[model samples]
Target: MKLFLVTKVVPFIMQLFVRFIYISSKKVFHHPKIDSKEPFIVAFWHGELLMQPFNYKRIRPKGKVSAMISEHKDGEAITRTVEYLGIDSIRGSSTRGGAKALIGAIKELKAGYDIAITPDGPKGPRHSVADGIVAISQKTNARILIFNCRPTKYWQFNSWDKFIVPKPFGKLEFFIQEPLDISSLEQKEAKELIQDKMLLNAMK
Candidate 1:
């Protein structure tokens, strides 16, 4: 009964919270390509996860979006939370079933589904990028669109990733970096640059 409530009821509450975020947000979208029908990867950090599903809906309401979630209990709850916003989640993470996550993302990308990944997520050293995301981008040949969202007014949780929740009627400065072609950069270089950029923006 407790587990059921956590999975079902908690996600319901979270969906409501996300709804509040959407309606209250003062949004600025930087990339015109995102407004198009072409599918791309949105590499976002774990801390700013609350806004991603809504971001997808706001940008291209009908475009398919998918992302990897963990196989853990907390992940199960979050998977449900995101599903409420109409995004599908696959169970896997870098520490567990990482390969499965990559395979799933690749399949979705090939099918032309826009995918998002929190490189420092599901547990984090905060703003760090795991190589799996880089691999997925390389395999899919999808340009990576980096997300840099900074809450102008918000609450920061005492979580490992210092999770953020924007205050009601507050603005969030969301800057989408120019799309990066993974084929042009070495794997390590690409991951490092992404991690650096995300960390820099989060600290801003």
Candidate 2:
């Protein structure tokens, strides 16, 4: 019953929540490489995912955006949220059915849809980059576009990922860093760089 309610209702609630964010907070985008409409890997920490479902329409309004979501109950709920909001989701997680997810992401990218990733998700140490994003970028030869959001006042959950929810009405600022090519960097280095760009200050 709980799963059914969550899967059915949360999507609508989340849509309203996203709208509240849009109306309550200020938004800004800094995409330096707008000349190229090439598909890239979009990443952010899992905690900051609350209002991300609105980002595609806010940033690339007409471009295709698909996310790599975990294959779990929570993921299923989130998949519904994204789908309801008009973003596509491919379900799989690092610990479960990951290989299939990677292939799906690659195919999506190849077909011109940008792939969104929570590098340290499906369980996280918070703000760390997992191996999946790096591996997917290297395999598909797609650049990783890391982004971040800092809200003036918000709710921070005590979950493993330190999940955050910005207060209904607050100042929210988003930063989009320039795309970083993973095909050129070693796996470990690529992961570190992606983590640093997402966690540390990459762009203001």
Candidate 3:
């Protein structure tokens, strides 16, 4: 019942509200690289989800983009929300069906879809990066770009990552770091580097 409500019913209402609110008041400041066409992996902390999708849709290349979502009740809502934004979603998490999720992500990347992941998502230790993102990048030979969203006005959920919801008509700042190429690095080294980059980019 909970999943049904979140996946089917709640999204219709939330989508309407979020679209109206986001469209009414949202300003984005971006520093995107000129060569953004190449397929790459996008990494962002989970807390900044609200505004990240909007910004990504603005700058992401004209290709299929997929986001990794947890197979939990909350993920149902997120799946719907992402779909409304016209981005595809793959349901799996580090805790459940992780291997399959990673394989699917790699296949998507290979198929030319830029992938998006939340290193500290599905339940997080708040800003911590998991190894899955790094593994996917290494396996797929995809470059990783770390992105973040800073809101001038928003509500902070008392969750592990302090999830933020930008208020309508508010200003949002998007920070895009240089892409980290993982094709050459060892798995352990790549994970460390990506984790550090994700943390640095997410900090205020």
Highest lDDT: give the candidate number: 1
Instruction: Record all residue pairs in model 3 with backbone atoms less than 3 Å apart, i.e. clashing.
Output: 25-169
In model 1, which regions exceed 4 Å deviation? Answer: 34-37
1 against 3, candidate with superior TM-score: 1
lDDT of 2 by residue, 32-97 (tens): 555356888889888887667665566787777888899887688788887877789888878778
- Better structure of 1 and 3 per lDDT: 1
Candidate 1, residue 56: lDDT: 64
lDDT of 3 by residue, 1-204 (tens): 976787788888877877776777756656556465577888888988766667677776365788999987668888898788777888898987798889889999888778889988888888777889878877777888788887778888887889888777786778878778878887778778877877775644
Ranking by lDDT: 1, 3, 2
lDDT of 1: 0.80
Q: Model 2 scores what on Cα lDDT? A: 0.79
Cα lDDT for residue 54, model 2? 62
**Model 3: residues with Cα > 4 Å off, grouped in runs:** 1-4, 34-37
Return the top candidate by TM-score. 2
Q: All candidates' TM-scores? A: 0.92, 0.92, 0.90
CA lDDT of every candidate? 0.80, 0.79, 0.79
Model 2 steric clash total: 0
Candidate 1 RMSD to the correct structure: 1.8
